[model samples]
Target chain A: MKRRTEVVLAGLGGQGLILIGKILGEAAAIYEGKNSVQTQSYGVASRGGFSKSEVVISSEEIAYPEVLDPDVVLTLSQQAYDLYKNKVRKDCWLIYDSDTITGEGVSDKEFGFPITTVAVELRNTRILNMIALGILVKLTGIVSVESILRSLEKNIPSQFRDVNLRAFQRGLEMS
Target chain B: MHDRIKFLQGNEACVEGALTAGASFYAGYPITPSSEIAELASIRLPAVGGVFIQMEDEIASMAALVGASMAGAKAFTATSGPGFSLMQENIGLAIMTEAPCVIINVQRSGPSTGLATKPAQADVMQARWGTHGDHAIIVLSPASVQECYELMIQAFNFAEEFRTPVIFLSDEIVGHMREKVILRDDIPIVNRKFPKVDPPEYRPYQPGEDGVPPLAYFGSDYIFHASSSMHDETGYPNNVPDNAEKVIKRLYKKIYDHRDEIIITKEYETEDAEIILVSFGASARSAREAVYILRESGYKAGLLQLNTLWPFPDEKVRQLADRAKFMVVPEMNLGQIISEVKRVVEARIPVYGVNKVNGEIITPYEILGKIKEVF
Candidate 1:
């Protein structure tokens, strides 16, 4: 029923959030036969600064690429949540990582899970965003799990592909 | 895997378009927002048996591109605000020497190095006038990632066909934005029209009936001269008034006389519309969305998106103004193209500018708000 939805993923640098945004957008655009635009903005530092990526998906052409007001948001850090929490629709589905970010004064219309904790338990903490991505897929069903799997295979290197795939599957199961 | 659809960034698509257009040389310096073009070119150019050189700076990069083009290669370079300003002099050189090449400006905000990572559509006028002197330039403004690929092919085609420097002016939002692009090999590709005259009979700068000089490459069988000063048919710098006058007239006429063929503008929902929104590049994206919003609300609003930035799309805009009540120009800068629109409309109709310049894109709501006020 959703014709258009904007999703924002915010985190500190080196959180692999940009990679997650790319995979989600590619899956929707390339496999789901939908229009998608991925726009990211980050601080000047290569790492250790605030960074975020926003993807807007629509059944028709996406006119404006940036997230005007998010339908869904996944904030992995306190600073990021504080900055973007006010920039979403009142009816937005807020998803946060409880292990990495505190839920103090967070919204009532929200969900929380330890996405990073799940990834760490799986023995590769870098796949935290993949877990977040999986939960997002379960919530919105923006793109198929098969599309995400294909994107993961194309984007991830052979050396670490198995772990990333496992992380995606585990995140899906958790959701 | 045959009909591969790609979620390609606009910058990456621009590079691919150049490669597909037979661009064999790339000389560039890395800058934010536009650096991906250079990075991808460096990686892909070599695999395709082309040359990719990271020049010392923008000046050298542009100079190298000019050198490569004169040596008979489809050459290009990409830059942002600061680098675009730096390459202006060499662009003028290329213009004067009639070297066919493409220079891409992935626009960001700035009089200097302003918001290198952010998007701005301020370079609309700079692409046409950045180079010194009165010269005719072809500038193409692409709105989407697919146009980023398709228009680059057009850019290369116009460069070779007209024997002039073509500017591919794309903004930061479109440059960094990623969208699904079809990478099919069915698009038409054009190479430069080479002269068939004998070595002793060839005149490198001589204009045919179309006023475009058939390019003769360096180290070719024919001896040729290329210079920045006003040159005659012999390609030697000429300061005489008659020779200079003829050459200048030919240069302007080559593009201006063919303006009808060179200028390109796309009209959206113009039928039975009262007010029209005129915009180009990334700002046009929002203008289009605003028009959609207005029409859905039963308002008679339309959009005129300029895909060809240079030559100002004068006659076409005038034709659109004939049917519309007024015009609204929204851009990232204060108001560059609005003045041109007014000039073409001759102020018989109202042409207003909705300006924004905070290193951000103009949103649909902003443009729709302005449109509501006008209504």
Candidate 2:
């Protein structure tokens, strides 16, 4: 049987969910030599509308690109949590930002991290997705931290790379 | 672990393929789901000393493409459904004038702007007959990012080789999705055949033995006239009935004579298939998954994925129909390609359609349900 991991990163449109999703897929595909596909959907509104990116990493060829049942989900907004809370399997790992979302009755395998609060402390709220990414990597081990760092170097602009790396390190420590 | 492996969206992959195929000019108006091609072209083309222009509308963009191609530049443009509709006139002009160019339509759902950012294969028929008249066109569809890169080169090659406009029909799902693509450096590139005759002896519309006229750029030493109106071997407007018939016949013959080379399809697990699912573009991905699920559960299912949409692989589908007991076509529109499949099958086997226009993909389970309901 081929090993596969389906991940959904959900948040508001401006929270960079798609960026983190690309980084995860790039790490799996470019660095690890695994097959990966990333797809995203967002509403019409630029900033506040629902946004989600789905990444499927597999040892075999991926025929269906969409995530039918996600093994891991990260939600940075309350609306995103509500949307995917019931869609995922019960044993799936659900990670949410405790700073903005309440995970009262979501899943037994749930971990709530203060993702945005840590980003605030790191002096840049925009790197919240990278911090959330670090926590997800630490908890699930879906991708190596070194691979993710290499992907970040290729994907992130040069001026903001230091701050984003700092935020990812902070989240790794928190996890 | 090669350095050439990179993650790329389907739209970006198309631009990379275009650049690799010696595309030196791009003129397009940005639209949702396809704007990435233009955005990336704007940045990439300048570095390579190519021209990138944001035309006033899709109409002007296509006109600019024809103009640029006539000047000996491999040119392309990207747009969606509404923009595609706007470009039909110039596309028809490109066909009539035998100007080589490429048009990438990252299709969205619509009669007219129904869903701007959603995926749809509804443009299948439009791509075939959208520009009108009794002319033949080449259209290629890609289901993955890698295919987007690979087929875009083929699209350019077909356009240049046939000296006609080729349409790269993509949908929102394939356009927006990102996947690993190996940027192979050893791709075979094809360019238009230039006339070997002197400037005075060049007859623009005169066909060689293969029924395709050798093209000469406008500003070269060659001086020739190209008009959308009916013309004879000299390429000026003749408007005689005999000239019209000869000109139109050559247009069709140039493509249909080389049909076997232009048409491409992929078949999976069809050696002993009882039921075959025929699909194209993004929905074909779902159909392939359905085939896998069905075969795993003791069903003899197979898939025939059409990578070339326009000269509709009637011969291949008909061959599959001879072997399979049943055929199903799953598309994002209300039975566009299914009609062609049914026509080719000739009611020998039961043909079914799984159609969806609700801005969501036709899932594999949905196809399985349709199969079980009929099985």
Candidate 3:
């Protein structure tokens, strides 16, 4: 019943962070029947560089796309974590990769986990964003777990749907 | 309208809107922030039995759209500032020949490639007069992603209805932004009014009562010449002083006469406000927020969102300016549309500008800061 929820997915360019952002947006719009906007920022390098995708979900039309002091910030790289942790609201949910980040400046609102480690242990490193997405949905309740899986199934290639779904479930159990 | 909703980026919404408007041909070169339009068009056009081409450059892309229009295909192309500069000459050709087409400029920062990946509304003036001619133009700006979708459909309609090139002016913020939109099945689509008479009787440049001349297809039995030269009623090249005047006047008259219907602006909380904030595209979104924040702090503020920029919505702005004591113009660029706002309000009241040119957006806080300083 929240009117607006701001979520940011920040990571390196190749980490599939944009994908996770899109899935979250689709889950909100397509499955949960909410209004969503997904905007992205990336470096000129186009690969393995800093990138961020900001998504805003609302019950009504959203005028502005850029999220200011996002409610939930998910970071996959240390640089992303360091850059955004200082910027978000004090009570903001700062989720980061425990394997890659030390949770230095943000220990109070931090929900650090070994995101990459879990994906690697699951034998698929590409599902790193999916794990974060799973945890994000659970902690914020922006959208249901079923909405995330449904969006993933609609977007991901048929060959990789099952593995991505399993990774999302692994993420859900984290919280 | 489909009850189901979907999250769509501004670029993706543009493609869907064009398709809904019956755009059958797309010719554009890929540019950052605007490439998603071409990418989606390439796939969507083919699926709908249309054609999509990656032209060698922006020039050819615009030229191709003009050529496709002659053959009676609703066509459009997208580009950024640098590419928009390339398409200027051809945009003039569309204006001179009275070709019906649409051009989407997903504006980015710079006079020359200042920031390819960033968002800026600096191209507002360029879109109005970049083609280097005294001709009429209709440029519509969209503030949100849904407007990106909705305005594009109107852009196509305006192009066809007036037999002129319509510019869908979107900044990078609106072009790259994503939003939930209901893909309505009931969009009002307009096609170019075709000639009903035989080939021998048709005069391509002759305007009806509305000043819009009927368009004839290339392969159709009703044959008519299409050229970039100043032509008379018959669409033949005529350099006579009187005939040239008629050609130019008619071209301007069509849109000018219909300016009331063509220009659109949204006024918010302005009934009793002492200050009016004027903005368009992403800047308007920020300005709207500033209005509410100002109200909460006991200062009465209103917002005038210019959805139609080319004709400049002067009458509506004048009325609003008369009621308000001051006007604040905020944009991502230094001061383009602010000049127009000043011209409209004249010296009657103070007009202030909040400008930023660092390839970053003008935030609500900045607009509020400017208002605070002036008051």
What's the residue-level lDDT of B100 in candidate 2? Answer: 96
Could you give the DockQ of candidate 2? 0.84
DockQ of each: 0.77, 0.84, 0.62
Model 3, position B196: C-alpha lDDT score: 76
| Predicted candidate 2 versus true structure: per-residue lDDT over A1-175, tens digit per residue | 5346999999999989999999999999989989999999987677888889999999889999998888999999999999998887787889999999999656777999998788888778988898999999999999999999999899999998998888888888988
Candidate 2 vs candidate 3: which has greater DockQ? 2
Q: Evaluate candidate 1 and give its CAPRI docking class based on DockQ.
A: medium
Best by TM-score: 2
The window of 10 residues in a row where model 2 chain B has the poorest summed lDDT is B1-10
- Candidate 2 predicts chain B with a TM-score of 0.99
Candidates ranked, most accurate by TM-score first:
2, 1, 3
Candidate 2 deviant stretches above 4 angstroms: A1-3, B1-3
For every model shown, what is its TM-score relative to the native structure? Answer: 0.96, 0.98, 0.96
- Model 1 spans with C-alpha error above 4 angstroms: A104-109, B1-4
lDDT (0 to 1) per candidate = 0.87, 0.92, 0.88
Report the backbone clash tally of model 3.
2
